[model samples]
Target: DAGVTQSPTHLIKTRGQHVTLRCSPISGHKSVSWYQQVLGQGPQFIFQYYEKEERGRGNFPDRFSARQFPNYSSELNVNALLLGDSALYLCASSTNSQGRYEQYFGPGTRLTVT
Candidate 1:
């Protein structure tokens, strides 16, 4: 049983470019969530999807978005990238959407902006 996995372990981008990060959840899991962690700060929740429906969203701007697939995989898309967006983008997966289940996190996709 593998945990969550994220692609492109690292990314380099310019201020206005858009990027899409991918994630695959553990087998049998049905919920996937995204988070942004700036250096020296806690992870900020970006989005959570369960059963292919959006369950929650954080305070992030409209530039941030995500969706879960029928297979329980997910993608996080960030548009109009800014320097401030440079951070470790983490993907977490759980068994349910009630926030009560244990969540497994990925190694994270490190994003760097210039």
Candidate 2:
């Protein structure tokens, strides 16, 4: 099976701008998660959705939002982007069965805010 995929491998934007990043989960996965990773730091959880419903969210500001489609794909939107928003946006697909959960991540979308 193919892994998760993210669009616009790289993106550049100016401060105060907005961006929308897309992600396609792996086949048969019903859960999707979004994360942000700054240089030299681990990925920080942003949001998670299961069966198209939001399950969890991290400490990000209101400028961050996301939605999962019926097809299991997800999109992350950031408003009023700041230079600190520059980082790798990651998408992960996972499965939860009998209390066991496994997640697989995509290559990630690199965003740069100038």
Candidate 3:
């Protein structure tokens, strides 16, 4: 079975620019969640999409948004990126069986804002 994966291991952008990060969930998984990990901080939930329906979101500004597709893939978009927005974006996926939350994570896409 394939594990979760993300693209563009690293990126750099100036203030006000926008970026989109991609993620692919493991086979047989229907739940995907997005998280942002800033320097020296734990991963904070950005969005959780199950069956292409949003399940949850965290305390982020309007500049942050995301969506899940039919194929179970997802994309996270950040608009008007700020220096504070520079962080490692992580994508996790897990089975929806009862009491399962030990999500598997992919190497995050690290975004650096100048």
lDDT of each: 0.93, 0.96, 0.94
| RMSD after Cα superposition, model 3 | 0.7
| Model 3 TM-score on a 0 to 1 scale | 0.97
TM-score of each: 0.95, 0.97, 0.97
lDDT of 2 by residue, 1-114 (tens): 889999989999999999999999999999999999999999999999999999999999999999999999999999999999999999999986757777899999999999
> For residues 1-114, could you state the per-residue lDDT of candidate 3 as single tens digits?
878999889999999999999999998888999999999999999999999999998998989999999999999999998999999999999888887569999999999999
Using lDDT, give the best candidate's number: 2
Compared with the true structure, what per-residue lDDT tens digits does model 1 show for residues 26-60?
89888899999999999999999989999999999
Candidate 2 ranges beyond 4 A from true positions? none
Ten consecutive residues with minimal summed lDDT in candidate 1? 93-102
lDDT of 3 at 93: 95
- Evaluate model 2: give its TM-score: 0.97
